[model samples]
Target: MDCREAREKLLLATSDDLPSAEASELRSHLTSCAACRGEEARLADVFGRLATMKRDRMPESVRAGYWEGLSARLREEGLVRSPGGARSVARPARGISARLAGATVAAAVLVGAFLVGWFAGLFTQQEKGTEPPRAVRPDTPPPAPRADEGREREPIESAPATGWTSDFALGNGPADRGEGVYAEFVLGPEAAGENPVEYGIDEALPQDPWVASIDF
Candidate 1:
C-alpha cells in the first residue's frame, strides 16, 4: 500500500477497528516506510492514552430517572393533541361571554334609568316661555237662586219714553193740527185794526202788499 493508504488504515488500527485485510496492508507498508511507521506509533500512543483514561459518568439511577421524566413529559404533550385532553385546559372564553352579557344588561338598565329620569324631570318641571293654565275651581251652586229672583219685574211706564219721542210730543205740531183732540186756533186775530192806533207807513200798505213785502 502507499503511505496515504497506510496512514488511513493506521488511524482505524489505533482503535483496533481496522479490517484484517487493511491491517495486513498497513503492516506491509510500515515495514517498508519509516514515515509510515513513525505515524503509526504516534497514532497508537494517542489512542492508548484515550482508552486507558477514566471519565466521570452519570449513575444508572440518574440516567433512568431523567429518561423516565422526559418520556412522561413527551406523553403528556402528545395527549394534549386529543379532543378530550383539550377540554381539560382552562378557558377564558366562557367567562368573557358571561361578562359581556352582564355588561350588556348593565348598559340597558342604565339607559332605561336615564330615560326614566329624563321623562320624570320633563313631567315634573313647569313649562318654559308660557304660564301654566289656572286650575278650574268646583262650581258653588249660585246661592240657591232666591225665591223672588225668577219672577219678571214690572217696569213703571215713563210718560215720555226713555229714548226718542215724536215731534208732536215735543210741542212741534203741524200747522193745521189741534191739541189734545180739540181744534184750537194756533194763529192770533189780525195784528192791524180797521182804524190805526199809531200811524206808520206800514198801516197805509194793503194786506196783499204787506204780505208780499214781508216775504220779499
Candidate 2:
C-alpha cells in the first residue's frame, strides 16, 4: 500500500485491532517505508506517554470515610451480620464497600446533572441564536444548479398593444426621451403593460438597498 493508506492503517495496528491479514500487509509496508514507520513510532510514543500518566486517585481520608459510611448503611439495611448471634455493628470493611457504592452513585448523579445543564445551556444559547461565526473555507464549492435551470430564459410571444393609455409624471421634469436609462421593469399582461418597474440611476446600487414599497 502507499504511504497515505499505510499511515491511516497504522492506528489500528498500534491498537492491535487490525485484522490479521491487514496487519500483516501494513507491517510489511512499514518495514519498507521509513517515513511511515517513523510516524507510527511517534504516535506510539505519544499514546504510551498518555497511558503511563497517573490517573486521579481518591484521597485516603475520602476512601476511609466512604467505607465507614458504607458499613453503617449496610448494617442499617441488614445486609451484613455480626458474630456471636448478636447483630454485629457496621464494620470497617462493610463501611468501605458501602461508602464506595455511595460515592459511585453520587458521582454518576453529579455527572448526569452536569451533562443535562450543559446541554440545556447549549440549547438555550441556540434558541437565542448566538452562533459562532463560521470560517468560510476558500475552497468550498458553490451551490448546485437548480432543477429549473434555463427555464426563465424561454421566450414568450408579446401581445399586440391596446388603445387605452395614461400619462404619468416621470420625476419632476420632462422625461429625457433619448437618455437611454437601462430600467428593468416587470409588467404583468393584466396591468395593461404598466407593471411594477425599477429604474437604475447612473450610479451602481448599494449592496443592501431599502425597499420603499411593493404593489401587487
Candidate 3:
C-alpha cells in the first residue's frame, strides 16, 4: 500500500476497527518504509499519552454509580437507544448546554445595548436639531438677455394724467388738473385774448368755448 492509504488504515487500526486484510497490508508497508513506521510510532505515542492523561482512575463503586446515573439521565431524556446500550452509553458532552446558554445571554445583552445606544444617538441628534448646511454655488457669469430684447415695451404717447406730464416747451412738469388730456394748448396773454384769464382761476372758461377743459 502507498503511504497515503497506509496512513488512513493506520487511523482505523488505532481504533481497533481495521479489517484483517487492510491491517496486514499496513503492517507490511510499515516493515519496509521507515518513514511510515516513524509516523505510526509518533501517532501511537501521542494517542497513548492522551489516553493516559485524560482518564480519571475511578473506583469500581464510583464507576458503577456514574453508569447508573447516566442511564437514568438518558432514560429521562428519552435517549436510551436499546436495553443493552445503557451499559456502554457514550459520555455526555462536557458543559455544552451551560456554555450555549451563557453565549446566548451574552449575545442578547450585546444586541440590547447596541439598540439602546443607536436610539440614544437618534434622540441626541433630535435634541440638538442638526440640519444639513446649505450648498454654496461658485460664482458664474450672468445670463444673456433673450433675443426679443427691447420689443417688450410700447412707448406711451404722453405721461399718465394723474402722475406727471411734460409740455413741448416746458421740460417736465406736474399736470395742472388731476385728470386731463395731455395735448399742448396756448396759454400766454395773446392766446388768452382781450379778457385774459390767469392760470389758476377756478372758473376760467376757455376762450374757445368748444375746447375740452377740466372742472378743477
Candidate 4:
C-alpha cells in the first residue's frame, strides 16, 4: 500500500472507525515508509491528548439569569402576567410616541396643503396674465381731482322780485282807473337793524316798471 492510503487509514484508526483488515495494511505501509510512520505517530499523540482533556460545562446561574430576563421582558411587553398578580392589565393600543408622531404628521400635511394652494393660485394668476392686487400703503397719496371738475358746476340764480307779489281785493289799479289788476310787493330792509315799513303803488300800469308811487 502507498503512504497516501496509509495516512487515510491512520486518521480513521485514530477515531476507531477503520476496520481490522485496513488497519493491518496501514501498519505494513507505515513500517516500510518512514514518513508514513512519523505521520501515524503524530496523529496518535494528538488524539491521545484530546481524549485526556476535560470538557467544560455551562453554569446553572447563567441559565437561570437568562430565563429570568426573558420572563421580565415578556411581562413588560404585556405578553405575560406578573407572578404575584392573578390577571394582567392590557397596555394602551397607541403609545405616547405614536400619538406625537401622528400630530406631527398632521401638522406637516396642513402646512404642505396651505403652501400648495398658495403656489397654485400664484401660478394660475400668472398663466391667465393677471396681476395680483397690491396692498395699499398708509404713505400712499390719494388721487388728485380733475382740472374741469370745479368749472363743471353751474352758478345758482336768485328768484325774480315779482314772485313775492299778491293780488289786491279793491280796485284793479288806482281810484281813477279800474282796468288793470292791483298787486302787493314785498321788499327787504334798506339798512342794518331797521324794519322795512315803506310802501308804494303806481296809478298807471306799465309792462315792466321799476318804480311807482301811491297814497293809502
lDDT of 4: 0.34
| The 10-residue segment with the lowest total lDDT in model 3 | 165-174
* Residue-level lDDT for 134 in candidate 2: 23
Stretches of candidate 4 off by over 4 Å are 57-216
lDDT of 1 by residue, 50-124 (tens): 322222222333223332332343345442222345322222233332333322222122221222222223222
| Residue 122 lDDT (model 2) | 28
Candidate 2 lDDT tens digits, 48-99: 5333332233333323343344335435555345433343332223332233
Error in Å for residue 8 of model 4: 1.1
Task: Residues 90-125, candidate 3: write the lDDT tens digits.
Answer: 433333323333222211122212222222232333
The true-versus-predicted C-alpha distance at residue 43 of model 1, in Å, is 1.0
Assess the local accuracy of residue 172 in candidate 3 as a C-alpha lDDT between 0 and 100. 10
What overall lDDT goes with each candidate model? 0.30, 0.34, 0.33, 0.34
Ranking by TM-score: 2, 3, 4, 1
All candidates: TM-score: 0.25, 0.26, 0.26, 0.25
Regions of candidate 1 where Cα sits further than 4 Å from its true position: 54-216
Q: Global CA lDDT of candidate 1, please?
A: 0.30
